[model samples]
Each structure stands twice: as C-alpha cells, then as structure tokens.
Target: MMLPKAAKDPSCGAPKHTGLLREELLVFRHLLGLGENPSQIRLGPPLSNSSLKDILFVSIDVDGPRDFKCAENSPCLVGISILDTRRLQFYMTTISVAAKTRSALGNVENLIKSHQLQVGQSNHLSYRSSKFLFGETRQIKADKVKTYLQRLIKDRFFVLVTYGGGAADCIYLEGLRLGIRPLYHLDVLKVAQFPLQTYYRYSLAKILDALKLPWQDLHIAGNDARFTLHALLMTAVRDWNYRDDKPKSKPTPSTQVTLSSIKTIAKAWRIPDQDQPSLSFLFEDHIIKERVLLNPETRKNGKRLRPEKTPEEKAQRRERKKLAKEKRKLKEARRPQWLFNLGDLLDNE
Candidate 1:
C-alpha cells in the first residue's frame, strides 16, 4: 500500500512524511521524483527478473546446513560473504556458535579457503577482524549471533545470498530488520542438470561438485558460506555472455508486492539491541595474510593445513595448471586483434 503523505504531528502540528510520529515530525521519506502523477515515482523494473553484473551480494549460510528457524536451539554458524561483481572482488567471514566447552573459534585460513574469499592469485586485501563474545548459554549464544552479524555487515548494502527453497525467511527478515538491503538468489540451482535429483533443494554440495571444487568440511558452517559464493560464481560464469545493463524482468505477480517495499521493510525491524554492549571483549580475528591459497610453508597446530605435496600430486597439479594456462592462451588468441585498451580490460577484470 502506498503510504499517505505528511500526516499531522500531534504535538507541533507539523507534517510527518516517512513514518507516523505520535509527538512531532521526526523524519520523512525523500521521494525525490514524486509528483502528482503516480507514474513519476513508480517507473522502474520489478525485481523478479534481475541479472547479476556490477552487483553487490552478501551470501549467508548456517553451519551443519541447519534450518535458520532453529537458530534459537543449537549452535549457529553464520557465514557471510560480500561480493562485488563489478570489481570481481569477494570477501568472506564465518561465525560459529559452539558451547564454551567445545572449540568456538574456527580456523581463519581454512575458513577463507573453503569459502572462496580469496579471489585471484594473491595481492588483494585479506580481511581479518575477529572479536569474541561470552555466549556460553543458549541465550548468550543467540545474542552473540546478533552481535557478530551486525559487526560483519557494518551497514553496507547487501543481498542475502543463500542456498535452499526460501532465503531462510527468518534470517532474511532479520537482515532486513538490521537495515541490510537483502537480495535473494533462491533459484540458482532449481533447474537441475538432471531430473531425478538426490540433492536437497539448492544443495551446496552438489553445486560445489559441479564446479570441480575439491570439497572439504562439507557441512561445516564456515565452509558452507564460501561454498555458496563459489557455487554462485561458477553457475553465473558458465557459458557466460555479457551485455551492458539488461533490464529487470517483471517480478512474479504474487511476489511483486512483498518485494515492492523490501528496501523500507527494515523500518519496522526491532531497534538494535543496544548501541554498544555493556562490556566489550575481543577473542580472535582470523586473517588470510598475504597468501591467497594455503601456503605450504605456513603451519597451524604444528602442521600445514594443506598436506605435503607428493611428487605425483605435484606432477598432476602442474599438468592441470599447464592445461589451464594453455586454454587461457587459446581463448586470448581467439579474441579479435584490437588496440590494447588498458582501462577497459582492467575495469572488466
């Protein structure tokens, strides 16, 4: 429903534009292009049929591939990915809520690798900011979940990326409440490559397998997050063709209304728990450091996360790398010979 304009404030007798105020006009919606003609502010494509390009995305997943509705119950592992398609940049962080008796902190190195956060061959910024909360009890864990989540997003615009039938309605709604503009890709894997599917709806494992990602920590909360991103990228890039600014396809009629106010829906989300916690504590901050891939030289727990390379494994890896390099060269060779445009090439990358 369209909001009525400028209701009178009870106290000061002023017009309140955005939301109703019992006392005085506090804030207003700035519909810059609004006019007497309804068409003026309403002219735009609906969301159902949007394409991915130059878009910002935040994909989230729970560890153990658990239902988001169960958040109040068991431990919660929250993986958040920030993807900037325009720059081909991806950043990822995962938070796991375990009992104080169990290992609460996850490996920053493995989390990064499993999540596909480190894009390209090194040199990009490796994000490592970690702090801890004392959530030994169920209630405490729930609060911790919210605490870390708010910190992770930090008010940047994001679309809630996830795998499955729905966007885990509660998490999506919660994110919206947090004022994070959440986007959904609930159909990334719906069109199964085969008919008699054995996988769950929008299964992350199956998607990873299709992408040829060497899977590890399948249901691990942190891994699920990075996998969601890698899977999305793989699907998006396959047989890819690019065009500038494809128009949004109209949203399905049933969903058009729900999505219409998505941007402003957060206005009704619960007020933040508190501006700042009564007490602040820092636990751990995992970082990828300078190396994108697991460095054979770096060791954790007196052992490297990546196994020592055998001669055969090394040979096979080299062969695969060589073939990939040759394919890249072949693709470049097929490009139409043109004057080098550094800016365009760099921008596209």
Candidate 2:
C-alpha cells in the first residue's frame, strides 16, 4: 500500500470503491459481531445484502495538539479499531507520532504525563488500559502515521467511521493530505440521531452510556476508537430493528456489558480539565506588567488582600467608622489631662 499523496498529487484520482451506505454498514457491523468477543458473540440474523461481506469497518479516533495544523510539525496519536466482518475478527491499536518542534513536543509530553498519572488509580481510566483492552501501541515520528494508516487500509473496501465530525480524525488525514480512499465515510455522531431519537449531540462516552455499554479511559486513542466501533454497532442494530418494527421485548442487547438501565450525564461532552487558561503564560510581559485595578491598595504581595463585602456589611462598616470618629474626638478633648499624667509617670521613673 502506497502512502497517501499530497493534495496536489496528480496520480491520486477519485476513490474507485464506494461500498455500502452508512445505514447498511451500521446494521451489518452488529449482525457480524464485529466488536464483541468470539466466545460471547451469538450471531444475529443476517442482512439481505450479500455485498456487506467484502467491506471492512474502520473506526478511528485521534489525540493531538490543541491547535493542530500540519501533522509534520505537531504530534499525532491515531487510534484505530478494525472490524473485519469477512473473518469475524476485530483488532484495536494506536499509532503515536512525536512532534518535530520543541513546543509541540512539550505538548505531547504533557499529554502522556497527564494520562500516566492516572495509570494505576481507580478514579479515572488512563491509556494504560490499552494493554488490558488488548491493543498494540506504536511510537513513531509524526510523518509515519499516514504510512501506518495507509498500510493498514490497503486494497480492501473500507468504511471510515468516526465518533465526531469530519473536523476530527478526518481533518488530520486530510490536512496531512494522506490519500486515504474509503469506500464510504460514516459519522456515527450523525448516523446515531435517527436511531437513538436524540436531537442533541453525544460524545463517545455518552453514546456508550445510552446504549447500556461499558466504556473506559476515553480520549485514550485506542479505547475511544474501540468504544466508537461498539457504539456504531449498537446504534446500527437499534436502527435496523426500528425499521423492521421488531417487538420491544425482542430488543438486541450489547454483548460486552449486561444491558442495565441507560444513564447519561449532562454536559458529558466536556472533558475534565479542558478549560482554556485565563492568561497565556507564553509571553513574559503578560505576567510582569502592572494590571489596572479599581483599588490598588487592595493588592499586596502579588495577591488580593481585600475581601469582597456585601451591601449590608458595607453599611455596618460605615456605622462603625462614624462611632470611631466620635470616640477619637472625645479622647483628643482629654489630651491635656493625659499628657499631665504621662509627665508625672516620667518624674516617678
């Protein structure tokens, strides 16, 4: 398999193989037990279309620099989940490419270090789950990611399925101008709407929750890719049954986890610790420069000394100030007597 050509490559023509529709591929993945364990899989009724056998289901997710440009300079982590329907087998893997530039390399290091911190902890699932999830992980230079993908996708009729929009995993491939010719492009995010009857969008984790399937270590490329594939399969099965008007009692449940009550978290799309910094630390001037403040006296030792007060507290403080002013005047009126007492004490000393 040749590496995908740049956008200007004349030899790269339009894709020749356009396989199944998004709808058909979704249903087919479910029936073939694509993402399930072989021991647990009990094959469902086959689809009418025999052509589905020839296609490969490739679901992918990527983790990269926050502001991604070309893949060459920036770091790239590609997670791929492949379902070979023809052979009734599936594989998950990740390809990590280090950035060429110092800044981009720092970003990559921070990302991996962050994930590594949660490795053995129970609180959050980390990329280390990739081993338990039984996926291979490879580290290479940023340029080689495309080559790896090209080799993996060689000659076979394939459908490229992704959790989110084209702007995600697809954009990296397109931005790098890696000439991947997929038989079909499927966005599970869009395909899921009608099947799941949801007007709102879903993240990969949220969708898995809706389907009553278990997902761990999201944003970890391989785990995300694997879950995305499973979500696709489950959504496809639901859509197929809904179209067939199958009885509610005969619903197909996911094989990975027991079909428990479906639960979804609000604001599930936002990853924790993803908020943008209030101040960019890249510029030294931004940190050292004096900032205009309403009360300059309130700032001390580079910290705010004054606490914010309510309206009632302010009124009470004003009343106290008035009392203190009267007391000070009374003390001043007896200043001569106090000075005389001080003189007598000095003489005794």
List where candidate 1 sits over 4 angstroms from the true fold. 1-55, 64-74, 85-140, 166-176, 185-187, 191-202, 241-349
Q: Residue-wise lDDT of candidate 2 within 1-349, one digit each (tens)?
A: 1222331254645243211124544444443433322234223233233222455678776666545563335544567767654433211011122212334322321111111111122222334434324234555656666666667666666777787774667766676565646656668877676555554567777888877766656777666776676676666545543443334464443321111110111111222232333222323344444465556677766677868899999999999999999999998997887675897899899
Q: TM per model?
A: 0.36, 0.46
Worst 10 residues of 1 by lDDT: 23-32
lDDT score for candidate 1 against the true structure: 0.37
Off by over 4 Å in 2: 1-51, 89-132, 244-349
Task: Quote the positional error of residue 269 for candidate 2 in Å.
Answer: 23
Clashing pairs in 2: 4-179
Per-residue lDDT of model 1, residues 1-349, tens digit only: 2221222234544433222211100000111111122223222222222222233455565432245455344434445555443222111111211222112222221222222211112121122111111111122244455555566555544445556643553453463356545432433344222111223343666666654544454553344555555554444322111211222564343223222222111111111235422111112333223434544568665555766788999999999999999999999888876535766888899
Give all candidates' CA lDDT scores. 0.37, 0.51
Q: Cα deviation in Å at residue 105, candidate 1?
A: 27
Alpha-carbon RMSD, each predicted model:
22.6, 21.8
